[model samples]
Target: MSAYTIRDATEADVPAIARVYEHAVLHGTATYELVPPPEAEMLTRFRAISGDGYPYIVAEDADGTLLGYAYGSAFRTRPAYRWSVEDSVYLEPSAQGRGIGLALLLRLVELCGELGFRQMIAVIGGGEHRPSIRIHEKAGFRHLGVMEASGFKFGRWIDTVLMQLPLGEGRDTLPDEATYPGTLFRG
Candidate 1:
């Protein structure tokens, strides 16, 4: 087992997080965005994710270097979708294939279950991303389906696969207020 620690991300982690995300956007297909999000925007999104009780986690070494991060966010804005959430996980290139992704994902699931979410979804970039698929499958996520050619990136159409894991059981209706939570969602 690698010696790494997982914890809630702090404002101090934004730069490292942004660097990780920028690396993905510029060099990998993990995210479909063609341009790196501005630091302010990233900070706003990070703040929103943490402020509303949505988990934003980071994995770090004993010396405090970031290795990976994962988080659970609202899947959609409709009140009916309140119990469903979308999860994202990213690791530093140097940390890939070292079990860091699995650890972060497992912890995200545990935290989401504790926060009362009933379903978790991962919108994977492609069906052949075996590492990502394996992590979700090993964590009990089922293959929901794939949206073929749903995204255009890098001058080509990219397929997106959806994986799901039910986190909790109970509750058939929303509360009287029924207002959707601002949990990593912009609406």
Candidate 2:
């Protein structure tokens, strides 16, 4: 068996999730936020995602230390966008280069597909952030395009890269609208 485990994140994991994201916000261009959000804020965001019936999961080692997290959020708030989702993944240093990130992402893809989502997009921050891009690529995502100089952080302009993957049928076949989930989406 692998040294790490991947599972759905719970409320109790918020602190560790915050810590992982804080590392990225402070030291890496993987995220553009210059300041780390507080733990409480992280909890609120986590609750929102879970409440929306989206998948929020984490990776942990044998000792149960959180290594990273990955989730699928609404790609857009519009009703038409309900079938699409955008992926967000964050990996703590301990989990980097070990394929744990890929495992987490692929799992999110699987869960989202089961939830009736048709498309998954990865909006990676920092155009140069290849490891994140590679993880998405490894999950079968394809390059869409890049938005140059869209964000200014740390005294430099950062680009956003876009990649997309088709979940079940992609666009080859029309969805059976009657069987869709979240039909009552109050969002």
Candidate 3:
């Protein structure tokens, strides 16, 4: 097993998180973003996600170096979407293929379930991006479909792959409004 620990992310992890995401924005199809957001922008995003009671987590090795991070966010802004969350996971280049991303994703799923979310959605950026698709599959996400040529990046069209996983009891039971995630209004 890898000697790494997964834990909730903190504001202090923003800089490292930004760096990891910057690399992806520049070189990878995992995200359709063309320009890397500044560190301040990253910090603002972190505040929005974590402050909203969503799950944001990081993985660190024994020496305490951050290898990757993952988080869940509201699938959409509407009240009806409150029970679903969109999952995001990113790894520092060196951390690829080390089981860290899957670990972070599984932890994100677990945390989202704890937060009363019923569905976890992964909109992977590229249809050809098998690594990400495989990771989500390994995390038990079911393939929904691919949105062909939904994104233009690197001067070419990229397809988005959609996958989903049920969280907790899913739709087997209804959520009590008072205990639903903060994205929804309490009863």
Candidate 4:
């Protein structure tokens, strides 16, 4: 809604993404990890997402200041779980309250649904992260309850809230890159 552009991420956006993620790790309970990964390691993780034909996108201004990013990746390694994906989204500390996270997440759902995903999952911190929960619910994800005390971080136990959105009914087949190469998203 603010005219930011969404595009598939390449290796070059790694540093911007890492910086945004680092802010969350340091200040917010959104991510359970204690220490932020180095830029190099972060790039490695994103590269794995790209290599798997998943969606990794960046929201940016015309001059390329990153506002936020969202992406979808395999929920589990097993082939049986290929049609379901776990989604991750993060906004720059300076970008919150401006709808960047919602915009990024909406685009993620667009891409995931087009790429043949049947179900999308979001894992959020319980109670303390209401903004994120509201964003996902606004975008149509259903609350699937919490995993109590599932993670230990910042010297205390944390709860994980799982939410999911089904892309659509049927369409259970796997993604066909051969038939749909270079198209960003299609219904």
Please name the candidate that would achieve the greatest lDDT relative to the true structure. 3
Weakest 10 consecutive residues of candidate 2 by summed lDDT? 178-187
Quote model 3's TM-score.
0.96
Question: Which ranges of candidate 3 are over 4 A from the true structure?
Answer: 183-187
Overall lDDT per candidate, in order of appearance: 0.85, 0.89, 0.91, 0.82
- lDDT by residue (80-147, candidate 2, tens digit) is 88889899999989678989889999999999999888999888999889899999988999999999
- Candidate 4 lDDT over 74-93, as tens digits, reads 77776656677889999987
- Looking at model 3, the pairs that clash are none
The model with the greatest TM-score is: 3
Better of 1 and 3 by lDDT: 3
Q: What stretches of model 2 exceed 4 Å from their correct place?
A: 183-187
Report how far off residue 118 is in candidate 4 (Å).
0.3
Clash tally, candidates in order: 0, 0, 0, 0
* Ranking 1 against 4 by lDDT, winner: 1
Q: Supply the global lDDT for candidate 4.
A: 0.82
